[model samples]
Target: MAITNNRMICRTVFAATLLTAPFQIFTSAIGQVYPSLTLLFALMLFLFYDVSKVLKTSLTMKTWAALVLVQIISLLWAVDIREGIREIVYSFSFFLVFGASMQESKRNLRSLTLLIIAYSVLTLSQSTLVIYFRLIPDVKIQYLQGHLAEIFTSPNTLIDLFGSERNNVLDEAKSGGFEVNANTGAAWVGMVGMVTMGLAIGLRRKLLFFVSLFHLVAVFFSGSKAASLLVCCLLALMYLTVYISKKFTPSRFAILISFVVLLTVAGSIVVAAGSATDFGQASSDTLDTRKLIWAHAAVEFLKHPILGQGFGGWSETFQAYAWRQKISDGYPPHDTLIRLWSQSGLIAALVGAAFMIAFSVEVLTLVRSGSRTAAWIGAGIWCGFLFVSIQGLGENWGLLGTLRMSPFIAACFALSRALGYYTSPATRSSVLNTSVRQIKYV
Candidate 1:
């Protein structure tokens, strides 16, 4: 009876986590202290579960652990040790929860599908609400209800009501959703939306198709160029996955060759475009903002090179350089790869890179497996996560900060791994056959 009771409680908590993920907007819409109830519940679950399970299942997670250890060691030399410690704690807590909570089963897959749809809906709704306010200038519920109601208004409205007086909490624009900034909103959409797209294709769930479309609309409304591009890339990748599944036998050589060719073409195009313009040209200056930030970051990385100036030191170092160059401080270089190299040194950066490589390989292995449903889903997540990671080249907040989406990405990968095992060779044929019948019925 006690074991049964425990099982029931675990199921309830997991379900609650999925449900709570969508409602996070309600708190963010208001000026509530606990912003992400989903993350909070996730953290609670992480603490309550067995710690050993994290290492036993996911190979990617073991690499992640090494990355964390590197970061912890860097804290010894960090100028702001307190901030460095906080960063470590935040990372550890997130991975711990994610590792503990995710499972491999049909029931969990269904739950994940629901969670993705809910999250996408919430983001779309938030963006839509903001757009509505923008279109209808006279939607003055706040002014009619007095100063207190100003807090109840959307971030954009609050900015209009209080102007510069708006607190950081109230400082939102339509570019972001429930996240702190427009960029964060767009980043989350890119990562989570990609995961959803993968799961949808893998499960062959018709509902997810529409949900993904809605997610794209939300990403578009968020006004993130990186995110917009990521969504387009995700669609292209999904199409490619389906095409390959139909035409090819999911061979590693074919997939690798195709990926290499695609990347080469894309890289060549970017390089050609950049080389066509002079550095001092108008086109260059518009793009040079990020380049300049990166240039400054590169210099900082060189100065420290090995152990680095330590966590939070890159920004300080960049600020000093920016002041000399008559540019502003407080804004990062908008690149996670370089930021890691600058802040944590080559060791930490190598660890991070290893994690990415390991995770990608694992997903690819799943894709090449006999499990058709698992393969498509794994492909979706791998492609989606790749899009987000590529987009991170220009947008640093996708990882290792308050705006980080890496944990969720990890969780999705873990889910894919779990689902891959659940749908083995013997069972996959049966599952696909049943799915075909069900589709025919519908």
Candidate 2:
């Protein structure tokens, strides 16, 4: 009875974290506490109950360990050793808490999908209250103490919270729900929004599919143009995945994915060529700024080519190089791949690339499998990752220090292990039989 109760409590805590982990508003309300209290407590419970199992069966353990080691070794070249060490500790801790807690199974995947949808609903409701009724907390902005004023007394502060800087559409008082910046909220919503849509279609829940559209409205309210564009692209991809799953063979689906990727790249190049120097409009200005940042980053990478400036070297490197570029120090290279390459150099970039490729291959395998449920979950996770990576080209959401996006990434990868669990002989046979029957009826 005691063991059973403990197991139940463990599962409950894990479920709660899944629902609340992506929203920045929750983290802000809790005073910027990282990894969350629930995560820590659950880590303890996991240690007590399933430590051996977690260590033995975990797919990401070795890769995470290698990544951690790379960061630790890079500290030798890091100008800011203290910050570098802090990053190392953070990655290791996240591995222990989030990376270990994941179990590869269809049950857990479905639960995670539901929790993501719930997170979307909660965020949308919070934003709606702030937008319609001027309801926002009167507490201090814990995350932005120095950059922003300590206390938010008026509705203007609340409006600023939702990233009104780039948000021309929403009213000034639009709150960012749990996140301090509206852009981050938009990015968070965009990722989960894709998941909700994918899950709805995968599970044949028509009402859930329609209801999930509200999340896009929430993203628009966030007022981050980057997020808005990314969500639009992801929504198209989400629908495409559904259509392809129903109509195409596995080999054709793979070809379609490749073709779409090439087409997206070609379109982006054409757009960039058309507006390469237009600094008047927002979209063009953003593109121009990223190009400049990437240029600067490439120059910096040449300075310390092998290991680069090391982990958490962004500010220090920027401080040294900003005078040359005539820009402020806080403006990081604005690209995740460029930032990693410039900071940790070639080795770190390779590690990051390998990690992403492994993750992508795993997700793709699941999509190509005959199981519809597994395919939907895989496509959702894959698309969410692609959105973040695309966003990273214009911003640094996926960087190591950005804890805001970390939990969401962790959730996707953790749930992705469902491929192995759901592809057993019995499950595959059942899925195959169902597919054949449906085709016959058609």
Overall lDDT per candidate, in order of appearance:
0.58, 0.56
lDDT of 2 by residue, 199-252 (tens): 666667776666566666667666565666667666667557655754547577
Colliding pairs, model 1: 175-182, 176-182, 198-380
Error of 2 at 226 (Å): 3.1
lDDT of 1 by residue, 1-442 (tens): 0123366566565555555553332245433232355555655665345545767767778877877788888877887776676567666755754654454223345555455455555555545543443344244233323544333233444444354322222322234544434555665666666666666666667887666666666776654544555566566766566455433453743675476458545644554576655422423443567778878877777777788678777766777777877766656657766766656778877777777777777776566665566556677777766766666666655243342354455456656665555455655567533532221121
Question: Which of the numbered candidates is closest to the native, going by highest lDDT?
Answer: 1
* Residue 377 of model 1, lDDT score: 69
**How much lDDT does candidate 1 score?**
0.58
Give residue 242's error in model 2 in angstroms. 4.2
